[model samples]
Target: MISEFTRTAVPQLVGHELEFSKSQHEEKFHSLHEAESVIREELEELEEQAEVCRKLFEDLHSDTRQDDKDGAVINAKYLAGSAEYAAYEAIQLAAMCLKLVEMAGREDEV
Candidate 1:
């Protein structure tokens, strides 16, 4: 009965479309948030690690961060690292959304 019902088909179609849109938007949002968070965390880590580098520089009386201006010029490095992690998280999110889409499609077929 369910397989032969047009009403059922209509709802599943609408649901799939809505889910596709919502999931895409949410996937982007999730990716953005994850990237932001990763950047923040990695920057903090780099700063902390730089401190260690600084300390090593200090113990040796070296000026490691001076020419770089407190790592001001290394934004690209941070983004590079952040982007690496971001892809993993974003891909996972996308896969999850696709799985949802696939499940919806399966239900629609039924």
Candidate 2:
């Protein structure tokens, strides 16, 4: 009698376990997809900012007058300083992303 009851209950328990596993898998995929989408968007925005920084640096250097040595030198220094700050910020952002990737890899290993 006990053996018969165990055989009958085991199949139902297995079926429920399979359903729970499938649901968990689906949820994990959805979360991964969302995270990828967000990372892609952030990369696009960073690329745009990088372009702007490049252009600003180029324009500043090109606009510097060889004839007006004093004023041009001052202006160039100011523009270059601004460009340096922007580049530093971009570097910081890249570092943050790198740290995040490293953390995710560690989590996966666990």
Candidate 3:
């Protein structure tokens, strides 16, 4: 009962189990691609934030003259690292969403 679209779209995520986003392409991306666009924008913003975190980290690490405030600097650096990691995870989520969009697009083309 598995159709070709499902077979193609879900293999990477579902393997050879022959599953699709829906029973039909019409059911596939009704709201899924919209979610993708939103997530992609969010991810891009996160990446930008991560870059800012990296810059802040450098500021915290440099300038030995600020040794008296090293604890504050260290805390800032750690917070930055956490933000960067969160951003990377968001980026990964965006990538996955994009993949779904591409799959949906391909289904549409068909």
Highest lDDT against the true fold, candidate: 3
Give the Å error, residue 90, model 2.
2.7
Candidate 1, run of 10 with poorest lDDT: 56-65
- Relative to the true structure, how large is the alpha-carbon lDDT of every model? 0.49, 0.55, 0.59
The whole-model C-alpha lDDT of candidate 3 against the native structure comes to 0.59
Preferred candidate (TM-score higher): 1 or 3? 3
Q: Evaluate model 1: give its TM-score.
A: 0.35
Better model by TM-score: candidate 1 vs candidate 2: 2
* Model 3 pairs whose backbones collide: none
Worst 10 residues of 3 by lDDT: 15-24
Question: lDDT value for candidate 1?
Answer: 0.49
TM for every model, in the order presented, reads: 0.35, 0.42, 0.41
**lDDT per residue as tens, model 2, 26-108:** 32323545556644665666677666666655655665634556655665676676666555444434443443454467679
